[model samples]
Target: MNHFFRYFVVGGFSLLVLSCGTAGDKAQAETVTERVENVKVSPLKTLQIDREINVSTTLEGYETVNIAPSVTGNIEHIYVEVGARVNAGDLLVRMDQNQLTTTKLTLANLSHDFERVKALSETGTVSQQAYDQAKLAYEQTRESVDFLSANTFVKAPIRGVISAKNYEDGELYSGTPILTLTQTHQLKALVSIPESYVPFIKAGMTLEVTSDIYPDVRFPALIEMVYPTIDASTHTFQAKLKIPNGDNRLRPGMYARTSIKVGEVNAIMVPYQAVLKLTGSNERYVFVVKNDSAKRVRISLGKRVDDMVEVFSEELAIGDQLVTVGQARLVEGVKLNIVK
Candidate 1:
């Protein structure tokens, strides 16, 4: 009876030990399976960005007039220099007036003689021929006197400054400009628009004009005029606009940029790394992934700002998963593994 009892206890102990071991093994297997299933990677997705365009242009003033000498004489005094400001009718140069003064005195004597002859003819004290000769002489002398006044001083016709000093004091001014005058109160920017944009460009249309001299600066201007004919050499039409220079900050011959706001709105874009460029049609492409799978999608491209490019594609929906990195390892219909 004692032996049978001991054998029963030992058998019970062995069974209990086997049962605990099996339970522990099952728990460990479950833990391992859970960890393996948690390890997963997915493709990164980026939002869409808008587009922009850039073109080169120059800045110019609305009007530019050259100061030309009006009469022939020696330039006696130059009152202004390059970059000096002047008002309309301001004295620009002076000439020797000796000849002019003498001509005026001679004309005064001829006028006295003509008046006396007219009085005598009216009283029948002189012949008609005598009065006619005096009248003709008086008219010629008046012309001579008028010509002398213009030869004395070269004055500014417009409110401008001396742009160039071609002569100095005591120099000859023979109806030729001793200096160049330019008015910069307003500036005109001329832009050549491509023939494709002819329909959109017209007089009074507003556009933006900028200058590098004042970085990031822009002003409002209108399409003051447009050429009716297109330039065959460049296949573009010329457009002009007026820009105000109230502070005289913008000078003629200074470089400028003109920006035309064509369009603006929201869009989807991707990093440049995600886009693939090709020849022939200038088409761009990007890669999209879903459900551990990726495919190369052909996409149209638009304006790019910085590192991002506008993805122009109907196939690419907003918030679509894309392969930003590890694109080289991806292909059409290829399997993918999320890295992060």
Candidate 2:
């Protein structure tokens, strides 16, 4: 009878323990089901925004010329100084005239001999071979004289300001240029634009440029040229812009910022807070509520408007609920209790 009593007690205790364990597990399951993250969301919408391409570059001269003589000689005179403005056809420098005078005298003597040889050949007094030799000599001397005259007087090829003067008067002409002339009436800016913008850019389009030195000024510019091919390494193409600097206020090598308005674009814009950066990477993403669960979507970002930024993604669509608030506390596929 004692043995039976002990057995009954052991069986009862085992049943009680099992019953308590089952109830605890049920309570724990309920707690987990109630744990829903509270978040605020905004519906995605398309906004019309101005599409602009902005690039920074340096201003350069419209035309630059290095004035130097073709022949090596003593520089007899330098008519222009640094910062001097010159017009086309203006005499810039004069080389030594002694060589030119000697060549001209030789040419005169050759002309006389050639004329005498031609008359003798016609009269049968000289052979045809002698006449030919005389004619060749005269022609050669005349060409030499002409070349000397041109090189002796160096003239300005274009209207520009003398930016540099390398040699002084009576200096021997070496390989270096005598003067550096730059056209300052207009300026050009070469900017590298991404290949994607090539379709929108074309020759003769108008653009706007600004300089930090002239913060209040907006210089008008026109597209002069667009490179036909893109750089494979950089995935960009070059564009040339011509800016009118009639006042001569803008100088070469000045820092400039250029803006080109291709056209307007319809973009999906969301609150800036909705965008989040992936940890340890530059990739950006945003979360949206999908079937009461948080769904992470990767995005490419564009220009930022006031309190909002442009976002692009294949998974995003208009009227989708985007999480703007309480996103930091949620993870992928987490149940969300949306709040107003």
Please report the candidate that would top lDDT against the real structure. Answer: 2
Candidate 1 wrongly placed segments (more than 4 Å): 1-55, 121-133, 173-176, 261-340
CA lDDT, candidate 1, residue 165: 74
- For 29-75, candidate 2 gives per-residue lDDT tens digits of 66545568999998899999997888999999899999877889899
* lDDT of model 2 at position 198: 68
Q: How far is 312's C-alpha from truth in model 1 (Å)?
A: 18
lDDT of 1 by residue, 5-74 (tens): 9999999999999999999998866654343111122233445433223445666656556666556767
Error of 1 at 19 (Å): 94
Q: Score every model by TM-score.
A: 0.58, 0.70
Highest TM-score against the true fold, candidate = 2
